[model samples]
Target: MEFINIALSNLPVTPENNQQPSEGMQTGLDLKEKLSEKMKMAVEHDFFAGIYYLQGKYGHTYRELSTSRNLLQQIYREILEYYIDGTWVLLESAAPIILRTQDAKSKHFLQLGFRDLESSRLFHQRGSNIGKKLYTNQINFYKQGIKRVRRARKYGVLAILESRTPVEEKKEYQYVSYDEVRNPSITEDVKEYDRVLNKMIGLISRQLVDATIQSSTRGYPLELDLIEMHQDNFGAIIPDHPHLLNRFLSEVETAKFHERQKLPDRSRPSR
Candidate 1:
C-alpha cells in the first residue's frame, strides 16, 4: 500500500494582506450602478410627489380630485419616465405644464373660498380623504424613494472616493488623532487592529453581496444592501435581509478572533 498525502486547502484561507475576496470588486461596481439609478428614481419621485401633495390638498378643498390626480399624475408619470430613461426632454416638456396646470384647481378653490369661509370649510370636510387613499400611495412611494436615494448616494460617494484614492499597503501602521495629535490611551496594537479591522470590514461587505447573489436568495428587498454598513463617504444602506447580513457579521467575528490571536497583546506589566 502506498501512503498518500492530503492537503488542507479545502479550508477557508484567512486573509493576510487586506483585499476583497472573489468577485468583490465587480459586485461593488454593479452595486454602485444600481444604487445611482435607484437614487435618481427616488429623488425625482420625491420632487414631483411633494408638489403634487400641495396641489392635491388645494384640489381636495374644491373637490376637483379627478382633475388634481390627472394634473399631478402627468408630472409624476413624466418624472418616473425621465428617471428610468434619463431623458431631459420629458422634464423640459413637463415643467411648464406642471407649473401651469398643477395649481389651477387649488387657485380655483382659493378664489371660491375667500368669498365664504363657512362654505369652504364645509366643502373641505365633505371632500376629506376623498382622494386620500390614492394620494397616500404617492406619498409612500415618495418616502421610500427618498430613503433609497439617500442610501444610494451614500454608497455611491464612498465608492467614488475609494476608487479615487485606493488605500496603500503600509509597513508602518498609522493612528487616529484627537484634534490634531494622537491620543495616549490608544496603543500601537489597537491602532494596528483598527487598520486591519476597517479594511476587513470593507472587504467583508463586498463579499457578503457576492455571497448573496451566489445563494440565489429570495426574501430580500427590492434592492437590499447586504452590508448595512455606512461611512461618511459611503452612505447607509439599511439591512433588508437578516440572513444575508448575518454572513457579513460572521466574517467580522472571524476577523476579530484572528486579530486577537495574531496581533500583539495589549497589557501592562506590574511594577
Candidate 2:
C-alpha cells in the first residue's frame, strides 16, 4: 500500500511552463489527482487481499518457494532449447514440450495475480527431469554459442578451440576447444581424448566416494548422494539414452573430459 501511495503521489501534470493556470485547469488537475489516488488504493487493496488468500489456502510458504523454483526451471529450459536447436521450437510447440508449457502456465498464473494456487502447484509439478536437464546442459553451450556469434561478426568462420579458459591462473597454455572437451577426435587437435577421459573418470569417482565417506562421518545422512550414485549406476546400464544428459550427469561430464564419448571409426549407424 505504501508503494502504491508513493507511486501515485509522484504523478505529474503536464502543463506549459509559461501558461497561467485557469480555474478549469485547476479543477481538471484536482480531479485527476483524486482519481489517481483512488486507483492506487484499489490496486493495493486487491494485492493484499490476494496475498491473504494464498496464506489461508496454501499449506505453507515453502509451497510458494517451490513454485518460484519451478518457475525459474521453466525459464531455464526455454532458453536452453532455443540455444541447442538454434530455433524457438518451444515458442510454438505445445503439449509434449514439458518446459515451455510450464513457462506458459507460470506466465498466465502470475499475470492473473496468483489467485489460483492449486493450478499453479499442478503447473509446477508438470515439469520433468529431462526438461530440467536440457536447461542445465545448455548454460555453457549458450555462453560458447554467443562467443561464436560475436566472432562470426568479424571472422568468416567460428574458430575451433578459440573459446577456452586459462589453466592454473596462467594464459600461457594453448587454448583448448569445447568441442574437444565434449566430442574429441583423433586429429592433432585432440590427440589424447581417451587419456583425458580416463583421468577425469578416476578423479570424479574418487571425489564422489570421498564425499560420501565424509558425509557418513558427519551426523547428516547423505540421502541425495546415494540417490545420485543409484542414478549414475542406472545411467551406465543404458548409456545411449539421451536422458543421461541431466544435471546429475552434467557435473560428472564437466569434471570428467566433459563426457566426450567416442564416435565410431567406421560407417555411421543407420536410423
Candidate 3:
C-alpha cells in the first residue's frame, strides 16, 4: 500500500487575550426600566392604598404593601399584558388581604402621625408628654423611612451610574478616597460609605468570577466591571446552578490544552 500524505490546514486558534467576563448577563437597562415602572406602580398603589387603609378598607390594604413577591407579580402582569396580546392574567394571591390591609394601613397612619409630630408642641400620644411621644414613635418612623429611602436611592443610582458609564470609564468609580480637609463629619461619613461600598464591590467580584468560570464553555467573556457595578444589592452570591462553575473551569482548561496543541511542532516540521 502506498503511503498517502494529507495536509491539515485552518486549524483552530485561541486568542491570547481572552477578556474578563461580564459581571451580569442582564444589564441594568432592563432592571432600571422595570424599576421605573415599578416605582410608578408602587407610588400609585401606596397612594390609593394609604387612603383606603385610612378609611379602614382592610381588604385593600393587603394589596398595596410593596413586598418583593407582590412587586414581582405586578411586573409579571405588566410583562404579560405587553408581550402576550395585552391580556391581563390573575396573579396568585399570597396572604389574606383583610388582615394585612388593616396592619399596613395602621402603619401608614403612623408615618403621617410621625411627620406631624415633628412640628407639634403637644406630646404626640399624651396631653402632657407630647414632646416625648414625638421624640419616640414619630422620630422612629422618620428615621426608618429615611434609611429605607436612602437604600432604595442607592440601588437606583448605582444601577444608572453603571448602565450609562462606559466600561473604560469604570476605573474612575473604583475605590477612591473622599477625605475632605474641612469637615470631620463628612470625612467619617465618606469613610463609612467606602467601607460598605467596598464590601458591595467584593460581592460583585465573586459573582463575576463565578459567572466567568461558568460561561467559559460557552466561549463568552462576561463584562466583569459592569457586573461588579450592576449586580442586585442583595444578589451578589454566586448562583446555585449545579456544576456550572466546575463545567466552566473544565472548559477553560480544555481550551488551554487545545491551544497548546495548536502550536507548530518544530521537531516534526517538514517531516
Candidate 4:
C-alpha cells in the first residue's frame, strides 16, 4: 500500500499570527516528517522481504522482515509518545492515516510470514530427500511463526481501534494556533478512509472467529486458547452479525466456565 503523504505545508496559519511558525512548532513538524519517512522505510523493507522470500534467499528475507517489524514497533512507540505529549497536534490530519497504515502493514506482514512458512513446510513434506532434523526445525519455525503472527495481529487491532477513537487536544497545545484545511474533498477523503477501516475491522474480527473455530475443530487447544485471549482484547468491535455475535458470546461463557472449573473450591475448607 502506498503511504498517504500528508501536506503539512497546507495547514492554514491563524490570521492573528500570520508569521512563520515558532522554532518549537517547526521542530515538531520536522519530527513528524521524520516519522513519516521512517514509516515509508518500513513499508519498503516489507516489500523487499517478500521479494527475497520468493527468491528463496532466506537470510535476506529474515533480515529485511526483522528490520521492518522493528521499525514499525519503534514508530508505534513514538506515535504514542507524541499523543501523550500533545505533539500530535502538529501531525494535523495525518495522525489517523499513520495509525491505520501501521496497522494494515502489520497485518499484511503477518499473513505473508505465515504463508511463506506454510509453503515451505508443504514443499519439504513433498520431498523424500529432506532430512528429518531439517524437517523438525521447519516445524518448530512454523509453530513459532504462528505465535508471532497472532501476537502481531492482536497489536494491529488495538492500533487500528486507537485510530478510530478521537484524540482530545491538550491544554498546552492550545497556544499553537492552526486550522486543518476545511476542503470538502479532504472531508470526503477522511470519511472514505474511515468507512474502509471499519470494514477492515469487521473482516479481521470474523477472521479471528474463523481461526478460533478451526483451531478448536483441529484439536489445537493451545492455538485456540491463544486466539481466545487475543479476541477478548477487542471483542467490543466485533461485527454486528447476530449469529456471529451470539456464537462469540457463547464461546466466552464456555471459556469462563472452564476457568471456573480449574479454580480451587474456596467454599470448602483446605485439605
Which candidate number maximizes TM-score?
4
Model 2 lDDT per residue over 1-271, tens place: 2322221222224356667644433433564355443443334333333454565744434443344334334333332222222111111121132233343432432323222222322223343323554433333333333233222211110010111111342234557789877986665554233433343355446552221211121222211122222222121222222221132222322222222224547676568
Clashes of each: 2, 0, 14, 0
Q: Which regions of candidate 2 are displaced past 4 Å?
A: 1-59, 87-157, 160-271
Give candidates' CA RMSD values in order: 30.9, 30.6, 29.0, 25.4
Q: For model 1, how does the per-residue alpha-carbon lDDT over 39-82 read when each residue is reduced to its tens digit?
A: 33333333344444665655333333443343333333322322
Is candidate 2 or 3 superior in TM-score?
Answer: 3
Model 1 stretches astray by more than 4 angstroms: 1-62, 80-133, 169-271
Where does the lowest 10-residue lDDT sum fall in candidate 3?
Answer: 1-10
lDDT of the candidates, in the order given: 0.32, 0.31, 0.32, 0.39
Off by over 4 Å in 4: 1-19, 87-271
Write the candidate numbers in order of decreasing lDDT.
Answer: 4, 3, 1, 2
TM-score to true structure, per model: 0.24, 0.17, 0.24, 0.28
| lDDT for 232 (candidate 4) | 29
- What residue pairs are clashing in model 4? none
Clashes of 4: 0
lDDT of 4 by residue, 1-271 (tens): 1111111111112224466754434444565566656666666667667767888989979887777656654444343332222211212222345445564543454444344434433433333243433433433433333333333434443333334333432223244434433332243445533553454456457552122211122122112222222432222222321222223223333343245337676997879
